[model samples]
Target: MNRPVFMDFERRWAISGLEDLTGHAGEAVLPKRDFLARLDELSGRVEELGERFGVALGLDHSVFMGRAAILGLTRRGQTSCNGTCRLIESGDGWLAVNLARPEDVDLVPAWLCRKGDDPWKAIGKTARRCSTADLIERAAMLGMPVAAIPFSRHPGEGRDPDLSSQTRRLSRLDPGLRQDDGLEGGRRPVVVDLSSLWAGPLCGHLLTRIGCRVIKVESTTRPDGARFGPATFFEELHNGQEFVTVDFATPDRLRDLILSADVVIEGSRPRALRQLGIDRDEVMSQRPSMTWVSITAHGRDDARVGFGDDAAAAAGLLAWDRAGRPVFVGDAIADPIAGLTAAEGAMASLLEGGGHTIDVSLSGAAAWVADAPEIASW
Candidate 1:
């Protein structure tokens, strides 16, 4: 394995006085995959924000990068279904199946007509019986987060962005030399999180811990998938936040919520948001100091969907066993990677005075990590 393992922690990346504000309570030889500047990229945003805002952000790697946010629930004897989300063989090809929620587990018998207590047993039997397409259909029908493992290793290695990875496409909605909001201190910014599931909500959770006034906005029809996780874990993530349910069909209410926020965090596709008359770029233009964070499976522009494990594999982050079989590197790593990255990006944009839209796509983030040059190769 020629992948780079770690980088020396940088000192200039300190966040002043954040320890007291966000209790420092936590925290990997990450595989030798391309993730050379990943930590720096995550922390550099804070450094820039600190330099500009005159606030020393005391960001601890143990807390911010590690599973600190999830530790609270784990200590309470709750666990996430990271192992359940695995690569399984299908009639056509391999795909990732995640039954993190009880609802997803309950839907198994209905989807595959397999009756058993163990969800994995039913899932494995169903996957063996069904083709990849069939499994995908059933997953969507049940609103499950599943993705087909991408097998194509692009002919080109690292020239074009697509050569390294595809599906998740990130683009700055409106480009211009903008000014920051220049909020010096003592003003707690309002963050309206219009995202669900792992990555987007995780970003919101991080922001909330760091003293942002985060408001989680869900749809009356479709609620957050995290609600299916352990009760304690779900509460840990959403504990200190306000909640509001809006009818996306109405659109006006959701639009108003986002526009009024100092920061906007969303995890929907472009078409979905557009249908609700919520434009990220338009919002940024309207409020110069506003930061909009868009989190998605693929990029906001494309509809190629994925969850954590498959998206990481789709971006070429698979770990090979001694026999050379491809296995998941870690537990739903893409979700945490994207979540932490989005949080840092959001904070950087806010601290530097705003007027930016950061698009953090799971597949894209995984692809970038995969493309990081091997340490020895470098």
Candidate 2:
């Protein structure tokens, strides 16, 4: 596949630090699809939106692999590039499990129903005896990010049937926020970012770069999970953004912040926000011109929890090794991809006069990129 000279340079620069971190050493693993091209396409969309808003924004594929560079991550074959997630073989199929949080590690014994010193070893031993379906169901119940690796010839060749159904359900939801007049001349958009981790924060960061006033909000009880990660990586996505902490018990301040924003970015399950008395419909009703970006593992209605690694694996976004076995493509790739897609969606909606809820799912975004026409033609 021949690409433009500029694109070739962008791909090489994007994958520079990531070259030795995707497949096993000396195996030369590559993704079934060109994820860099997909990223380039999304970056172009964001750039176009910036132009419409009279902002000069320069984006490239380097954003997708920025985390790997910050963390100095390397590929570990069945293990995720970030070293927090793993692809384990179950009796029926393969599953990706991510123990990204300390609490997630604490729940490993309960997930396996036995105590063990090494979580990965214990998980692998128990997974060999249990069916992938059962393992996934139990992990979902525990709020852990676990996904069954569906079979596919290419990154987006075949998706999990359940994911397709969820996507359809998402499509039928209330279409975008109520339409309003586009952003006023000389007025910068206000963005309330209530999302944690990479995807949502990256969206906020991009918006900030695009001349938006972004406020990063977190609950006092449940702050951003990324705070525990590498400090520099966290700062990269959040620099120059306002920070606020709200008390979940009394989230009136959070509601007020959402109501006062031109764009709202959140990455929580639907029910989680509903339980906190922050309904999307209600909020949008109060502010018809607002654009809400909802990022999730699946659709808004699906209760299944997912992180970047498991969600990408579930979407069949994997690299093939020399032996033809699947290996992870990059470090929580779904997160960055979904983040860029969400930002682009937000920008497009705003350019169209607002009143839109951009429902971006990590797995769904990965599937779209994997199956992008550009990748197929290339």
Candidate 3:
């Protein structure tokens, strides 16, 4: 079997495509970091797993550029390519705020303790008066996707030597089971996808492409937010997967569906599912061979609210423009990256006979790529 290699030409091609898709008013704005390199590293892991499983994987730069193409999105400098997130200057520092939902827009008055015809203007004015910490704290408490910019360097500055060792992108939450303890060899695994939106669903989609049976489960009250997004984009991610809806108030059906799966993917804060009567520790204890992929904004232990744009900003993944201002790199760049990372982690766990909780966070995943030494020169 042949292994996939992300060649230099392919990386350049990917970058060119991304630049074309995300350019502002026909002018290309390259990101400060080599995002293609990050995608290459992540795709390589998935390809290696494909090779190990005797399956052919032909992923390329298209994975990162797909949603943008489907949604016809473009870069907006300080605003995200998707136009829902923005980089606001707080009193002490920079903050990223995403008002992707209508409810988020409605909460702007409460968030700033003042009302305005334009939510962004109100947020900007209020943010300038408040500290980054205060804004982020209040936003998190209100279930808003807000984050503080962690770090930024000038164009010619050298990479921080200590940063790479400071944070980990992927974490193992449980001890590994024996190699022979899980599903018997040559049997297809069933994945119960209890995640919505981009990251978790993308993970399940990739697993489905790799021969797993993925069943997407959404709550009757709260379906995947992506459903309200571009129809083409949503279809692109979930074209052939099976979808099931259940009432959370009555979670017996949901619990049964989760317990029957060999792998489970969820993109909720830790307590969301517990309130729904789905305890991860208990589920893992019952099915010791199962792989649980947990996707969060921060980590499983942290309660901070984050979305792709804000979390990526929190991870210091912003691009620096010519005027030395920080700008968003791509359209919710962390979402696809986190999704790919989660898929890789889930595959690795399954290959090792399951029984692991793979924790992959948006900020951490973006940081993992941002901390790359080679990105400093880009």
List model 2 lDDT by residue over 1-378, tens digit each: 455744564466335545566787556465656666666787787777667665777775567777877887777888887788888877766788989878899999999999999999999899989977789889989999888887733455444445563341122222234344334465888999999999999999988887789999999998998998899989988988999999989988988899999999999998999999999999999999999999999778778888998888888778767665778877888898899889888887766667888998998888766664433223
Whole-structure CA lDDT of model 1: 0.63
Pick the lDDT winner.
2
Candidate 1 per-residue lDDT over residues 1-378, each given as its tens digit: 322322321112123211211211121112344353564465565445444444554554432323433433111001112445566666655667666566767787877766888877677777877777777777766667676655522324212224233543343322123455334466888999988877888788777766789999999998987786666666766879999999888988887888889999988887778888877777778888888888887676656556776677656665433333346544455776787778767766665556777888897777766666554432
Extract clashing residue pairs from model 2.
21-75, 176-356, 176-357, 177-355, 177-356
For each candidate in the order shown, give its overall lDDT on alpha carbons: 0.63, 0.80, 0.78
Q: Rank the candidates by TM-score, best first.
A: 3, 2, 1
- Writing each residue's lDDT as its tens digit, candidate 3 over 200-248 gives 9889988887778889999999999889988987887787789899998
Provide C-alpha RMSD values for all models, in order: 7.7, 4.3, 5.1
Q: What's each prediction's clash count? A: 11, 5, 0
Better of 1 and 3 by lDDT: 3
